[model samples]
Target: MEIEAISRTYSPEMACVIFCCRVFIKTAAAEDLEQFVAYGDIDWNEVYRLAALHRVRPIVYRVLNNTNIPEPTLTRFRNYCRALSVFAFERQIESARIKQVLGQQGISVRMYKGLDFTKVVYGGDISLREFTDMDMMIAPGQLSAMVNVMKAEGYVCSQVEYLRRFPTNFVTNKKDICFYKRSPMGRLFGFEFHYRPTNFMMDQSPGFDELLGKDSSPFTHEQYYRLMVLNHGASDYYPNLRSLVDIVMLSQGRVVDVPPKLRRYERLGQELASRLLNSPAPAVPADKPLLKCATLITEWQLTATPRSGWEKMYMHIRFSSSFLHTLRLMLRAMHYFALPNEKDINNVQLPLFKLYYLAKPVRLLNIPSRLKKVFS
Candidate 1:
């Protein structure tokens, strides 16, 4: 189904959240901050959700610092920033160690995202951005060797290929994905290694690995690279605000210059970020059905609670790539939610797992409510 946002779609609370979040990420100018905050009586809860969903908590914390925010809410913001600081520290160490190990074997690991780019954005303070895991891109030929090296280093590397999850040979980059941790039951990955960058479907990027031959070390000078990442995220409708912030900060910083050829793509990202800050309404993707639903659901979910079946289905449809994909994802999601990890192995075998398929219909019971919500 084609889902699009009609004019003036976002609620007032969401508008403020977007405005507040964008201005903070785009620029830290004193006057700009004052004007945005002056749009007073902020729904602090909505601000929290926007920050949390976009993974820009530290930046949001900075904006809310000298304001009249409530005690409990302020405490939550402080705690989140503190926790992210500790986590980013640990990831930074692991990323460094991984690069060291890989470098020993003649692989140059140039880290991006997470702590790597935080310095450019946060005035050299790596703690300002949360780093849940590291994203590494290496040569395609070294893929197996790198995995073997990581496994020998006491990291539990998952066997799943990034190809199954995302495109490896995208329009621009060649990338494969893998996750690693120190233990089998680790809750979070220590690293998320990619052989290449994520690709954008619309914009054509000169593949980073192609030009560098997997030998380049300095990402700070690669204008096309930064432009490509921004274009990739924007074209694909990435939900995270940090991505837009990445574009805004990269544009503001002197770290990289936009190459003449890639400036068009850079402008695409720059304009989108500007829209969030200046537009009268949200930057809802009317052309992209799935993206449209996601924006709506996010706005709705952030401002209100008590999700009815109708709302869930309305979101599930748009989130799915297609009708069949929805069924596939729904089944997968149901299976995941239905089982407890602590269940006895003997009691829950393959046959028992198959029983979870019954949940498909239960999840989709109100077909029309979802359809109605979308069409209306």
Candidate 2:
């Protein structure tokens, strides 16, 4: 869709965001961006707020730095981008060291998203992308070895430690575990080790070997595209501009053959990217209702509008591909939220695991205060 259509469908602020963060290959002309900025009704403050909410501040800054935005607004983005660049550089060095340590222990790792995409998709411009943690995919059988190696290197596996006190079933069903450590500068870094490519609730995740293929080469564009689609779906189709940018950049010149089970969600993601970033639409048709619902949720997320639990659940159901799929997701969600996890127990063991469910409601009552602290 065009910027005018985006403005009408969403708002002028969102249209400005699209103009600033659209993929470089298909980016609107310089004059077009300037024209949007020139409009008196344009809210530069709202643009900055939405850009930061969508985690695309760096990309926005890159496009608008030379434009006529207010110096105060431009300064905020400039300072954020500069800080992100420094952190990204530090992360790169730390990641290499972690990868080398794992390699020496005979564990082959494939890094995904985050820094990897910054290099491959954004041409090594770390300022254009932000990643909170490192995602590494390793063989399922080697998870124990990988965790040990990371701990030896001073990374703490709190998730693993939490799971240890739980039943074996919890450990078996996990798709990944995160290891965290503080750099000498006191900057916290997370390294997530994945045994499976996607979440457990999703369709059977591809094996590590299958993703790497026989020769175990790095991920091809198609592989990255497939993983990206699955990850986006797993995230409940949240409309993140950085993720949409990845979709546009990775699908630039290739036909990505997503698995049959995941094609619907891929089309949903493509439709979102196509609408927001002006990327090419997917060949497959998406369910209209699902698309409409997703668009509504996207608007809410991008605007930082609060969504009630029921509203979120309704949208998740609407995004489902089929009745059976909806049922599965609902059941999984209920099982997840109803059952007490590490957070509920806080390392306290109970004679009956069922008892944790009772504490669930009490724990949920504290959410409002927690949210206030976070957003204050």
Candidate 3:
């Protein structure tokens, strides 16, 4: 399945931005960050913008502050990313309280993504993990209980306005429920409760019987690592760079026997992460056939970061590394077109609410030409 790598070209500025971000990783050596900064003449605004796009400003902010880069620019960047640590801390604390309540109520909850990811990847430091929202998972049967518990924890019910414009599949297909709330400080926060974290071929979501068996051992917690790898690289249409960061950090010096299906993407993720970020990623056995075509997908995506709003989303879903990935993208699109999201159910009355299904194709057909211009 090898084809010549697609000729994806990146501006020098974007490449520098990407390189600088890798320097902030815990595994990155200070010498590398210093040497790159020493010779690079970067536009501060462009670099900041790119870092913000990848949601790595917290790390980028730290890198800029520690370097000999001008103080005024660093100060401005600091102010912009200043809220990250506080927000991350706030989310962590709130999530902890919620988890405690769930435990006392005989309900099960596991933190993943935003809060827990930082602990694993950033060594339990809240400041290092900047995320869009806090994510947790609970059994489907406990969803109602989870909502009540969150409400009691001072979280108010809020709707995802964006989902109103999309199809039901967009929300339902993921098999996760997202809840929104406004913090005491007037900041909006979210908690995404995923019933199925990753529906990849390897999904072995704990059956209700296994809820109490959540492994505490770092190594033996096989399900945690499995979900992390699949969500970041294989199962998702939009791959997160942090997932690759996790693999490099989590799998280093290990010799676990990875499933054949899972191993390919695991290796691909590490290699792509290493290539894109200019970081030292762990490697799999060389004898295994490489998905050479993935580089193009990675290259196209890595170079185009710092995009916002629509452009960011277009890249997230449109970029593909392989045949199966393209098919997954199509399936997701079908979900978006045919499935009615929570917004639809709320705004539409029962019985007539079924019309929302009819609305998907119509809304898709009506997607503004400007929004479609990127693909063209």
TM-score of each: 0.61, 0.85, 0.73
How many clashes does each candidate structure show, in the order listed? 0, 0, 6
**lDDT tens string, model 2, 116-141?**
86777787787688779988877667
CA RMSD per model (angstroms): 10.5, 4.6, 6.9
Model 2 stretches astray by more than 4 angstroms: 5-10, 23-27, 209-215, 282-286, 306-313, 351-376
Query: On lDDT, who's better, 1 or 2?
Result: 2
Top candidate when judged by TM-score against the true structure? 2
Determine which window of 10 residues in candidate 1 has minimal summed lDDT.
1-10
Per-residue lDDT tens digits for candidate 3, residues 1-376, read 1111211255545655555556655445667666666776667777677666665666677666778877777887787666777788788788887789889998887777676766765677777745877777677677667767777776755433323334343334545667777877888878888776555223343332232235644423344455555566555523545555566655555554444556666667667766665555565565323444355546555665333434433433444445686677667555544666555556545454457787655455765565679678
Worst 10 residues of 3 by lDDT: 1-10
Q: Candidate 1: misplaced stretches above 4 Å?
A: 1-9, 22-39, 160-174, 182-187, 200-204, 209-217, 221-235, 253-264, 279-376
lDDT of 1 by residue, 1-376 (tens): 1011211354444554554565575443545455545654556777678677666778777766776667788899999888777677777777888899899988766776667667655677887765576777676666667767777887764343322222232212334445566534354656666554443122244555543345555445254345344434423433456665666565554545444444444444444554454312224333465446445634443343445544444444454545776676566445444432222222223334345345334443656578889999
lDDT of 3: 0.59
Question: Is 2 or 3 the stronger prediction by lDDT?
Answer: 2
